[model samples]
Target: MMFDPFGDFDTNGYLQNSLRLKDPLEVKESEHLAFEASLEDALAYLAKRKSIDYKAVLKTHEILFSGFYHWAGKDRSELVPHLAVFKGSKDDPRHTIFERPDLIRRSVEYALELAANKKRFRERPGEVMGQLAFAHPFLDGNGRTILLIYMELCYRTRFAIDWSNTNKDDYLRALSDEIQNPFEGHLDNYLKPYLLDISSRDEWPEMIGGIKGLDGLDKEGITYDNLDNPEVQQLYKTYRSQRID
Candidate 1:
């Protein structure tokens, strides 16, 4: 029975993969490089797209992590199929169940809908983020993936978070709280003070990389969704058509 929560890894604790890193530090370095490269791909993709949606979210993940994980573009519902959570407080923290696999598409589409409205996105960015975070679509790369997508959403709205000035501890704590009580806007309150006029997307990767990348949130393991029915395709189509290309 394998007991590693991070999936397959070498004896030295590095993620088992082509780069053959020997430890967490080394693995992080490799992932940073991969993220930097993918950030460019994501920017190019966003430039060509008419609007963002759940598929764009998946493409962002695929662009960022495809070099590292074979399942980069696939969400946990498709790859890991089961109930998973961020374990805490006596080994079981209170958590809202993640969107079941069959509902993943619809859940993300809903988030995209919230994000597409500039006024609502600016007023309730945390709610939009929390909904997507609760969805927890992918097994790995959720933080990085979501951050990039959120930034893109902000770009579309003509705003940006001056992440350089944001405190990591406060942001993470608020994120956890937001995840626990999504509609309260705790994360938005924390982030709103840092919001600024839009900036160049080209600078985002390094700016994000400087913040230490995605760390401290991986305890939540991947899970699968056994729900049989899928919805949201039609809704997504209607939503996409309504956007002002």
Candidate 2:
């Protein structure tokens, strides 16, 4: 019952890795490099796709972390069905239930549908982004993966978040608020000020990397091996069948 997911540090207190690096700083540095290198390929892959669905979301995760984690493209439900995850501080923890994994798929699909509307995408990016964050699909890397996907959605709709203008603390706070009260638009309001016309994608990876590489509000992970049941698997199959690509 290890409550801290990122606390699985090796002897040196560096986070343990699916890859060989044992030094925490080295692991962090390597992951940053991996993300920057993979971001272009991920964006290119997105360009060929007609829509961003759950599969595309998984693909983004894969592209971003495949070099660092063998389980990059998989969801928490599949990898650790019995595990529970939480974000936020000890006093006000936000729990994520892996019991009903299909909800993750539904949330992403719902976000994509909302994003399909240029008006809603422009006016309520927070709502869309909040839903995806609430879904919390992966064991880790959800923030970075979703941010890229969110940016891509904006690009398709002809808009982008000026990451340069955004403050990391403020953005994280807004996202936390949105996660807590998802239907509300706290994140949308926070982001509205920074939303700008679509700009070059070329510098986005470097820009986002500098802001707070792979940082997310979610905290803690504990695994329970027997969480998945037949019904959930069926739901996943149904969702998988609906993917556009």
Candidate 3:
């Protein structure tokens, strides 16, 4: 989904093989519902836990990984034995998952602050993702977990993520820069263009009409209400134009 419409990347067939549901209706009714519910739980748990309970994140991780591994036919507990946090031996580059937990923590903290300070920013979602990725909190499903976290946050906060319009090369590159670079200059530079582009749109059709123009595949479970918001409508128009090109 990320690579196909926007890039020349080849399809892997992984999802086609893994998704065994019968039809689009089955997908919308069962798989998507379960997936969405699990995501909401994860995001709410992370948000409620961030300030009051350090253990909350780990508990949230357990639920998230367990559901993911259950779907994947793998053992969740074995993949991540403990709650990951910034500082300690986990920061060693040789260890892999624990390497640079501090950086992950910093990113999480910064994203959380942004959510708190900005009217448009989604709380818990981006921060949880930034935190989990930086910590490499789990051995498996980190990517999915982070993405779900982001989605749930966006849904709760009403800021839609333009995943359909996003370029995976650019998105992954920016994530890598934040994880690898000491100065972290490239990370912000990468996301800045996306932010500016979406915010630049001048006008849009009504939500009912505008969102109807999006690729059905791109809609996921995103609501017309999200598109109805003035700011979100602008973004929808901006992304729709990009999709057109």
- Top lDDT prediction, candidate number: 2
> Which one wins by lDDT: 1 or 2?
2
- Backbone clashes, each candidate: 3, 1, 1
Give a tens-digit lDDT track for model 1, residues 146-229: 888888888889888888787776886787687666667798899889888875677776777667436424433333222332
lDDT of each residue in 181-234, candidate 2, tens digit only: 565789989999888887567777676766643553332333322225554355
> Global CA lDDT of candidate 3, please?
0.38
Instruction: List the global CA lDDT of all models.
Output: 0.68, 0.69, 0.38
TM-score of each: 0.77, 0.77, 0.40
Off by over 4 Å in 3: 1-37, 40-56, 67-132, 151-160, 196-245
Cα lDDT tens digits, model 3, 193-245, are 33321331122112212322222232222111222346544543543354345
